[model samples]
Target: MNAPRSLDARLTEQRNPRTARIDQLATLEIVDLINAEDRMVAAAVGEERQQIARAIDIVVECLRAGGRLFYVGAGTSGRLGVLDASEMPPTYRTDPALVQGIIAGGLDALVRAQEGAEDHAGDGAAAMDEKNVDARDFVLGIAASGTTPYVHGALQRARERGARTGFLLCSWPSEALMKTHDVVIAPLVGPEVITGSTRMKAGTATKIVLNTISTAAMVKLGKVYGNLMVDLQVTCQKLQDRGERILMATVGVSREEAQRLLDESGGHVKTAIVMASRSLDAQEARQRLDAAGGSVTELVGTLPVA
Candidate 1:
């Protein structure tokens, strides 16, 4: 039987016959070679920083305006999307539903391999419908070869319905599949040291891209304060301690006074800063942050550093 026409079936332009013999090397040498190649991934990503920043700006705007962010993929690519979506709530206090992931085989794929799942295009469409996805959000698809059925299906459908689309895959310019999205970030990391096991190089690239997408988007949404996780969860005592310190340092209040204002603001870090720095009450602090669009820095960057 002829193989399916896929981005995978497509040939890579880099012709390095030496890499095919990578396994014949001593184990240590092979590991060293792989590690050496891995270093190039960051440089590739660095070159795409502007593209990454643009995606972040668009996604963050949707999020703050009450829109959702969706990730779609298959296999290792799918798992990476799930991992990023799962982390946002705990790390940045986002509503879990607002940031979501849809893998080809559903949640079971995260634990065990679901090889057949990748072939089903209907699964991709069904998953998006199940989530009520629409023009109000953004969809970022992941397909290392830039041609996973599930990823392409999602992006195509997203565009059909007026939802903006973006892609994080391993490809280059002039690939027309690249043109379907508002932004295309194909961090061309070439091939895997182990060949066909995209779970290696391709997976690493996917994770790095997802990390950049979510973290930078959150930062643009005012979820960060001068590199500190200003929007970090206050569900634990450690977070409570950190929040109090942020209050003290940003407001220039004595430690004792900072704690007092933190208590007064009900342990909300941004509000506490407003009270300590601006002498505003909890209600007033809330208003100030709202007025500043949730950016503590914008709300108080003019204040003397603590």
Candidate 2:
């Protein structure tokens, strides 16, 4: 009889028949083959659209309740989580603590490979404790194989602490895993081009999912106005220019006037629009924005032509 198959024998770890002889392929052929494999990632993620949307709602709920969203993972999974978390503060002007990433090996692991760090379940639990995860917080564990001890331990401890937990896996997880997480996002990107190398397709899928979740949550929080990132912090020249452009396009103002409005609103595009539309001073515009939940459209009711 064949021996029992371990978790590594799962689909994500299995070989892809399409790229079986990739080593023998020409340079151009290899690129074409890799691109073909990448084409499937989006559709796989699309299949989990409902679950991804639900995850976003859970995150939004946690943030609205003054709680935070945490992403726990190891290796490539961990890196992607950190990348997404780090970008949110700059992109949306949200507090860094609002969205956090906890890799198994900590900051040092970010640069070098620390594969051994993922073995300690106790350490994973300790990280959750340090973060003070509670009922209001939501923690999402990213594990390509759905079997990372570090991720599993973190989610388990997070649940024990009354935190909402979710799991993002590249494989079809067992029934126990499905039951454990409040949300399970399985993109099922299938096997990698280079067998067992999850950093390829799995990494791309994780990036896409993280992007969608954070972007949607920010939108729901009114960090965006239509398709524009209105809550962006003007800490640099590029952002200042973008902010001015947003004001000019939204309110039909000249570049100079947009800069003036931005100055009045302390470089906040949303507040600048409110100030311009309602003929209010910076303080009154901020008050109206706060009252209207920082929604430019709601605060102004209707736009006024230049």
Which candidate has the highest TM-score of all?
Answer: 2
**Residue-by-residue lDDT tens digits, candidate 2, 1-306:** 543333666778887888888999999999999999999999999999999999999999999999999999999999999999999988998999999999999999999989999988888899999999999999999999998899999999999999999999999889999888899999999899988899999999999999999999999988888788888878889999999998888888999999999887888888888888889999998888888877776765544444
Looking at candidate 2, the ten consecutive residues that score lowest on lDDT are: 1-10
Please list all clashing residue pairs in model 2, or write none if there are none: none
Q: Which has the greatest lDDT?
A: 2
Over all chains combined, what TM-score does candidate 2 have?
0.95
Alpha carbon deviation, residue 87, candidate 1 (Å): 1.7
Per-candidate TM vs. native?
0.87, 0.95
Against the true structure, what is every candidate's RMSD?
Answer: 4.0, 2.9
Candidate 1 has its poorest 10 consecutive residues by lDDT at 3-12
- 170, model 2: CA deviation in Å? 0.2
lDDT of 2: 0.91
